[model samples]
Target: MELDNIDFQILWLLTENSRIQWKDLGEQIHMTGQAVGNRIKKLEDNGVIKAYSLIVDEMKVGLSYTAFILIYMKTSNHNSFIQFINEQNEVVEAHRISGEGCYHLKVKIHSQEKLNLFLNEILEYGNYSVSLSINEIKQRNPLIATI
Candidate 1:
């Protein structure tokens, strides 16, 4: 779908707070609530808006440790390893890459002991190098205008 300035404006506002009421959003863009809703529905139908997500405080949730693991596979077959990571709840993100390793994973766990146990489980598939995050500087979605 082709998005005009109005559609971009709607997206910009939605990005700031997804829960904003349609009428309030319409007031901001100088349109009726029904019109705004129509545009939003079309955006969803065309797959412009995939899903709404929440940002949680890891420290508050008891997910205190963030680890990045680079996996070097022992063999060429990767199907089993891929399935393993997919089933592990601690793994938040996984990527297949072209450089030093076969895959890179971002994981969150409650403690160091849990991290060690997770690493041991990973050894069946491959060797890994892990790094724990000291602090998170920034985490955000891309601005609508940039898109």
Candidate 2:
């Protein structure tokens, strides 16, 4: 569906705070609560907005390391690898992409030892190259960039 400016505005606002009341969201976009609700419903039905998520502070959660892994699958069988990632708590995000790598994973760990253990386990499916994040510069909703 082609989205109008108001739809984009609603999406942008929701990305900032999904918990914002429909009335409050409407206020920002100069619409009524019912109107905003209707727009949100349509967006949901169209799958433009998948789900709401919580942002956890890694420091508060005792998670110290943030690592991005570029996976090179060892074989054609990927079901096992997908299942392995799903079972691991540290893998926050995983994606199959059309680029230099087969898969990309974003994970958080507590220490070097933990990171090493995770990397070693990954060898069951494939060899991986990892980049550790020393400091997070920015993390914004990707939709914000398009808007």
Q: Estimate each model's TM-score.
A: 0.90, 0.90
Per-model root-mean-square deviation over C-alphas: 1.6, 1.6
Clashes of 1: 0
Please give the TM-score that candidate 2 achieves against the real structure: 0.90
Candidate 1, residues 1-147: lDDT per residue as tens digits?
A: 889989899999999899999999999999999999999999999999998877788899999999999999999999999999999999999999999999999999999999999999999999999999999997766865465
lDDT at 46, model 1: 98
On residues 56-112, what C-alpha lDDT tens digit does candidate 2 reach at each position? 888998899999999999999899999999999999999997888799999998988
lDDT of candidate 1?
0.94
Segments in model 2 whose C-alpha atoms lie over 4 Å from true places: 98-100
Q: What is the Cα-based lDDT of residue 72 in candidate 1?
A: 99
